[model samples]
Target: MPKQLIIRGVPDAIARDGWWLASDATLPQHEPPSPTFPILGEAMKRRMPWIASVVFLVALGDLLFWGYVPGVSLVIFAWAIFAVACASRPPKRRVIAPALLLVLASLPMVEHAQLLSFGFLTAGLLVSVAWLRIAPSRGVEVLGAAALRLSASLPVAGVKGVLNCARAVSHERANGALPAWFSAGYLMRNWAFPIGGSLVLTVLLVNANPVFERAIVQAFQIDIDLFSLMRRVLLWVGLGLLVWPFLIVQAPKAAMVVTPPKTGIKLGLNAGSVLRALVMFNLFLAVQSAMDVSILFGGASLPDGMSHASYAHRGAYPLLITAMLAGAFALAARPFLAEHRALKPLVLLWLAQNVLLTGSAAMRLELYIDVYGLTYLRIYALIWMGLVALGLIMVAWQVLRECSARWLLIRSAIWGAGALYVCAFINFAGLIAADILTRATDPTVETQTDWHYLCSLGPAASKSIAQGTWPKLQIATPFWATNCLNPQPVAMNWREWDFRTGRINGYLAVDAKMRAVRDEDPVGR
Candidate 1:
């Protein structure tokens, strides 16, 4: 007898002869075990389930792993999953935007009580199957058809968008048209390939233990994790990519009916003002630097040195939030008051401030040139204070654009975060490079292109980090970058110097803990 399931209040044949009702499910007798989509009853029965399983597994694993949770949620999750499977015989769940959103929103809380995951899993499965109407991406022609479907449903949208998508896809396939996400001409055509690959990459990341930790932190904003930040950025970028094609392909048609960008700022003239604005920015930095000094010495005014989720805390932060208020109020209240030009002097003041801040760090670095051995200090505390101050000052003149934009998830935060990410990545790379170059012994370094390379199931990499002598080929290095975050680069840098000078053995990024492992000989000598 065929395996059966009650998909819709009735018994249905699920799989047979090694065939699955869906791709992932297979008959016990089939050459390979097959899986069931559980949403599609009959349509899925006739097709080979390989692709369905692949897509289903991505969504299902997340579902099962997340556990059972339901509400309006289960229905939505099931719909998304079904929509993906039906997109093709081995159809994918990549296009189920709603289910994707549900997964994102459904993560367990900080304490890790996963009742929420269970709710999400069930809700996710049900909800994923509900979006049968959006229609999957085909060629531009199909996309254009989908556009018409979307427009007919919208009072604001017209048929022009549908026509434009059709034309663009045709022109691009023939003469090569460019999509907006591209910095140059014709960068992306098929969103499916990238989106599909991104899902795969995300799964690999999900398996990595540290990557999981980072994902948890980003969802909760509980702590600083480099891989977590990197994952969030990539996830957003991928989401942006998925959204961009759909939006841009519809742009020309959409532009015909929509309001244009605001004209108050004036793009060309605004370019020149950017320099002056930057000067004011430096002044803002100065105020913050001075504020930090006064707070640290004048008396504890606020949480100046530690991280804060917001400005409510009454800490004399490295940033001077109050100082920028005067300039901001004037800029906003009266743009033409012509009274605001004095903001220039503050620009010079901020430049002076950063000079002091950088000098202070440099001075300390010099003190520890070889052996001062300083403890941890938040290096970018000053940089952030300065940038926030500058953006705040620029907001005063009506020239700062989005400096005062509302704080919205994945929007306002993403901008500041993108900048911070660059800073963090550069900081990490620089420190890691320095550690490896100067270390007393060679360490295991995983330079797998991007940071996400480490987010996967694998044998431990750090077990072999920082052992053996220079001029020797074999050594162990740290598996996860987190392990080396504190003791790295400086320790690594010094040891390598020792090795090159014939004072010790090898070159791998090592920490203070590896001091004894710096040499090749059994003796300490």
Candidate 2:
């Protein structure tokens, strides 16, 4: 009985020891295993497909864009591919919808690759990337932040990509032996020597005999443009850097922290300060407005020494700056508007004056344009003035409704973007050309149109130039006609061909045929 009890007790003792060993109280604690290469660790392994896609896209970009001017279709397709690749799995409809809109915005580039079109495309890309990565509820808030992050990432993305790739290869090597051909040591030893030696021997043989050199040249038939090669390589590097950030899509670790507003700080801005500023600002602006009304709208003659052109030129841009400054002051004074009843009305009056001031600036620009003829810059100025006027009105609305700064920012961005989007598609070059041509043809107009400036607007203005009924002696088959109508060194491939270029080409062909028929039939001329 004693022996049996001892055996049972021994089993019980063993069980108790095992339970204690496995229990939290007795278990030995251990830290997680450290990653050999943190950048190319398990998390990065899951993202291998993304990195691979980036590499593929970079190569595709080279194939599509290298040695060519990319068309709108190519631009859209490339951006779509990038956007799709970087998008989260099972893409949300909200995200897809906006991305599609952005991609479609590239359509304007199909007509003519203007700076406005380029800007829209660039903004679209940045916004798309931002949406994919951050998915901010409001785009206006994140747009600047995303742009800043992207700019910061661009410098280091390439180097980081290279290091990650190297680590990935090493990681794979550690997992198992790679094929001999794929191994770096194998490549350096077996492939490099033979290729290098063969090149050296081939060069020696070529120089040794003219017949050998001719044979080598004929057999190989390799023609390399050094400049072209350099350009392609640079494109690869630049494009790789640009695309890598979208692939990684690292969100900031923490939300942007806003510092709490200080209670004790006073910057001398109060109801009184705002009232004083508004009073003085209104008086100053009123004086300017009275002068503008007299000179521009009232058609009063200029002062003794000031020509109309001089007056218009001097005030056009400065008044615009002044209006912008007035808008800024109004925005800054919003906090004080509710403090004083008079402040709100005064602010509205100020904004109203600013709008009128913006209009006067526009009139000034118009007068200048009337004298000097329209150009791209003047068109932009006109558009900007319109925006400024609208913005001032929105500022007044904000003050009246007590709208948040965010509300104002979002609407302002929308208006500005909408205006730019519209401008992107408009044929401003053609408009400028037509306007200048119309003004030049007027019998009473003294200023001569700058034909060289018109020509510099490129093929977009070609149609207007070709269709214009010029004075008989003014221009007889202008030399710029051939240059604009038949742009030399035509697009090398469809990737470079745009709708605008194609239309121009088609028109040229038709025009040539018509001219030929007309030449044959003297009565038609």
Candidate 3:
């Protein structure tokens, strides 16, 4: 009374595992599946064409940038290539936001190739790539994590990409079928003799006929500049390295990881120590604040034998550093503020004073600039002071809300980046030039304009200088400025052309025409 089952076309293992088969019946045998290492998946195979195109397009960096200053070409190279690469493998979420930011950041590069513009562009690229790799619901912390991952992978991305591409080609060849005529073995056997014979016959003909020799010489002549060739090769490699990371977006495994709180002995950064530090800092800052209000802001005279300019110049930078240290202290003391309620007030007071101090430092810089003249450094100092003030405000907000340090840092970075982005688009050089020229012409102003510094601001300030009529003011234009005013016609292709340079060139042309007309007519002059 045993169970009997009949199976047809089944493996022996299945029949042995409980199924019964008839003795006369036959079954087919199948081999076990082997392990596989897919060098190129179906998706990757589809993207191969785009990947190849990006590689070829980036390789042309030598042609686009060589012997020319970067301008719109940088914008084109950075944005267009990145766009195409991103399109090849579209992100799952948050595409429009990053795309808009990338475009906005690159727009500055189209105007000019200043360090600020380049910096913003680089930051924009990193952030956009990071955004593309993370989830839609992710926060700035996740974005930062993804960005760090991308940056960490950059050093090896190019090599990894090349290996991947090579493996894909091999994979395709191993799996695909080729026509007999196009197969590697077939081509080698059939074409080698013909190609070799043609080369030998061409050489013989060149030796036998003068006309053939001249034609051969003309056709085969290659002026191989080894240096140029090496440079282009290096450029291609560098661009490949820079571009591959963006092309292959590697999403982070996790947005953030929460670690358990450490159960160790508490450090000295407790309530007592924080309270004492805050009290001491507040007292010290209070003293400085009083001095600033009395002497710096009230327009009162300084100590005997000390000039206002000297006082302002000496105090501006040091006070800024002091504010920065104060900000650091505020951030450190944040943890203790909750336990010791009294420390919060003290910290807030300290931060408020630090903001005041930043303002005073900015006022001091203004005073010094009024006596002397405005320069790039002073403008930068002003911008730094503003950022420090904003940071202090953010620290105060963090304390009030009892937010995490990560929250504070993320917000601070966002505000700072915004400030920098706006600063990138500002024409500071033009402002500095106009300020100096205006002060120089004022009969009551005693400031002496540094024409040398003006020249160093480059073509951006040239229009202001020209309009200031330095010749009539009895101040001769710097030789560099003269050259800028009458720049020789140098051949520049479209890649090197930028809005700033074009505007300057146009202004110079019109100014030249006006000058010529004025010289010809006495009334116009």
Candidate 4:
């Protein structure tokens, strides 16, 4: 007779005549084995064809386009997902938005490719998974949830699953694996004869004719660096891991919305004290506002030996920081002052004044740009001021309407992302070149144009440099000859052919023709 022992939360062992009997079944079981146990191997076996196809597509893209334009990699990644979606059972229609967005994101590769490509790619991937797996009605909330899960799920399950799948394939190969239509041996068998025959014939022809051999060798000279190939392969594998989880793992069905419980406690500060503080703060801001109006707008004489440009330069960045601080104070103070009736109106007035202060900061930057000439930094500063103004407005709306904090943060983040994405596609360097050239030519503008700075603006400014007549500007003969006259040929494949670079090349050709005509003439050319 077997002893029926109830050992809760302990190992299944029993004493019998001073000896313990043990078997594999004697081990304590925390939970029953899942029917779908060994999910990684099973899933990989089922999806191996699609997975291999995706990896091949990524590798092909790396070979063809990755060196030329980084953004092209994102497009290839999106296409991989699209291909996988097409293969999925009962295919997901919802992935279209994110896939299309990712494709649209690739257009910047030809114009203004930059570091933001990776971030844009990440967001697109998250959205792809969220849209297909989560409810559509969740809207932007899905982005936040997807972002949260991304960090936890991506590195943990993805790398492990891939390694396990590799192990499974190895194990299967060792144990007489079942042959599939898409198996490696099948593909090799089908392609071997044609590929081998073509190679043999090509080699024979190459040996027969020197011209043919040279032409063939030169035409197909794949300048592939072994180290670069390895680096790109590793990067593709990492990207593959990122994408694999999205296809297999389920996204959060609903966002975890945490509503803070009402504390029933008002702000810690007394109404009178807070009101008094605001009154003093407003008075201080009023004095600064008055000074700005008089000095910046009214064009009053400087108090000492300070030039107008000097005053403008000194105030530009500092005043921007001051305005930012004022804005931050208002945002931080709004919740505390919600119960105070008189303070809310005062807060609104304070915010409005801060907006005016931001405008003054912008004017200061513009003044500095006029004196020192336009630069990438000045352009970005102006744009930043505009965003700050927008942010202040959003803060006011949030406070007054009692909007959800999460909602406000998500919206603001989205706005910032959209702005960055848009900025990435814009040819700001061209605009700067145009502005600088225009300023240089204007009779009223006496400031000497920074030709050195213009040259430093990269290929986008090449056309402007080419268009300028050097003799009138009294630019250095050596500098003019080296920079504007002689343009170096930019070697690029089709993928790296940017709009600005293409235009620059056209200008260079025209400039070369002009130089030739001048050389042909005897009129002091």
Best by lDDT: 3
Descending-lDDT candidate ranking: 3, 2, 4, 1
Q: What lDDT would candidate 2 get against the real structure?
A: 0.73
How many clashes show up in model 1?
A: 76
User: Which residue pairs clash within candidate 3?
Assistant: none
Q: What ranges in model 1 sit over 4 Å off?
A: 1-55, 58-319, 324-332, 335-377, 396-415, 427-525
Looking at candidate 4, the ten consecutive residues that score lowest on lDDT are: 11-20
lDDT of 4 at 88: 60
lDDT of 4 by residue, 88-183 (tens): 624433556765765665566545445665566566656555555554565656565765675468776667777877777776655445344335
What lDDT score belongs to each candidate, Candidate 1 first? 0.38, 0.73, 0.77, 0.68
Better of 1 and 2 by lDDT: 2
Model 3 gets an lDDT of: 0.77
lDDT of candidate 3 over 396-470, digit per residue (tens): 998888877778777888898888878776778888878877877777887666767876777777677677763
**What residue runs in model 3 are displaced by over 4 Å at the alpha carbon?**
1-47, 59-63, 90-95, 129-142, 164-194, 256-267, 297-300, 470-473, 476-491
Lowest summed lDDT window (length 10), candidate 1: 495-504
lDDT-best of 2 and 4 = 2
Which has the greatest TM-score? 3
Model 1, position 404: C-alpha lDDT score: 29
Tens digits of per-residue lDDT, candidate 2, 73-96, equal 467554755565455423442466
Per-residue lDDT of candidate 1, residues 1-525 (tens digit)? 998865664234432333544567644543664332233223223323533344343444344323232233333433444444444422342345644654543332111223443443433333333222333443222333433443343332223433544555455434323324332333445576787899888777777778686876689765687886786555443332322222212211211222223558543333236446556666666675676456444754655664321221223232244444434433333332234565444433443454455443333333332221111232344455545444443443333242222322224344564554344223232333333333423233322222233222111112122331222334333467444322233222211121121211222333333555655454756
Q: How well does each candidate superpose onto the true structure, as a TM-score?
A: 0.27, 0.76, 0.81, 0.71
Show how many residue pairs clash in every candidate, following the order shown. Answer: 76, 0, 0, 0
